[model samples]
Target chain A: MSSELLFAVVGALIFTLGVAGTVLVANLLRRILAFNLMGSGAFLVLVGLAQRGGESDPVPHAMVLTGIVVAVAATALALALLRKQHEMKDSEEELTEIDDG
Target chain B: MSATLAFDLLLSTALVWSAWRTITANRLDQAVVMFIVFGLLMTLAWCRLRAPDIALAEAAIGAGLTGALLLDALGALRKGKTARRRQ
Candidate 1:
């Protein structure tokens, strides 16, 4: 198989695994990681598929570059949100415990 | 197989393995480390695919920045959990 096709296939596999992890993993942090995996896989597929004609394309490379930056930003935002949520839950639990006591 | 083809095979294998490892590691730290490894492998893959620009971005942003963010989040989570436990 050509390298392009090979990479694309692997990308699809990674995407599938990411989907499974995102759906099934209970940990919010893990879910973020899985979401990242999915984004990486999609970027791979985008680049790999465009290059299947045996000539590398610059357009897809540009797109993937943009995608990488966006993914990182998204990751940061998600992590911040998760941290806030965790803190809120802890405080809520503390409040409930104090009430019970 | 030619050297380039062999290298691609090696890279692809490593990529898949690391990606899988990142997902399945028992510890959060292990998984985060694996994710960084996977990102580095992806940078290599982009280089092999003739996209040096993407490779550089992947190394700097994807691997480096993402790993830092993950570690920070993990540390915060651990600290919170410990504080809760001590209460």
Candidate 2:
């Protein structure tokens, strides 16, 4: 089999695994990590597809590259939101606990 | 087998494993480290895919920047004791 085909197979498997991980993991951080994994796996498949298309198709490669950077930025932003949510939940719990006491 | 194909197989295997572990690691620290390695491996994969520009962007933006951001977030999670989760 060709390298491109190998990559497509592996990439699809990895992408499925990543999606499962994201769904199974309760922690927000782990979810973010899984999302990145899913993004990378998709990118890999896209690159492989581009390779199979031959040397002239730079479009897919360029798009995938853009996607990689965008994914990281989105991850960063989501992490910040998760942090905020954690802080807010903690404060509310503490307030309730103190009131009960 | 051609050398490039062999190398791609090795890289894809390593990357898939590392990324899988990054999500499942018991320790958050270890998970973050594995994720960083996974990112670097992805950069290598981009290069092998005949996209040098993507390789550079992945190395600098995806791996380096993302790792730093993750480490910072990890520290925040550790240092903030005021809002510990009940679970």
lDDT winner: 1
Q: Give the per-residue Cα lDDT of candidate 2 at A54.
A: 45
* Per-residue lDDT of model 2, residues A19-98, tens digit only: 99999999888888888888888987887876764462588778987897789879989989988987787778788988
Candidate 1: Cα lDDT at B24: 88
lDDT, candidate 1, A13-37, per-residue tens? 8898899999988888889999899
Candidate 2: chain B TM-score against the reference chain B? 0.88
In candidate 2 the C-alpha lDDT for residue B39 amounts to 86
Error of 1 at B66 (Å): 0.8
**Model 1, position A30: C-alpha lDDT score:** 87
- Native contacts kept (model 2): 0.48
DockQ of each: 0.83, 0.61
| Candidate 2 docking band | medium
lDDT of 1 by residue, B1-87 (tens): 588888998998998888888888999899899999999999998987889999999999999999999999999999999999998
lDDT of 1 at B72: 95
State the lDDT of candidate 2 residue by residue for B22-80, as single tens digits: 98899888988999999898888777677888889999988899999999998888766
- For each candidate in the order shown, give its overall lDDT on alpha carbons: 0.92, 0.83
Model 2 regions lying over 4 Å from their true place: A53-56, B82-87
Query: Is model 1 an incorrect, acceptable, medium or high docking prediction?
Result: high
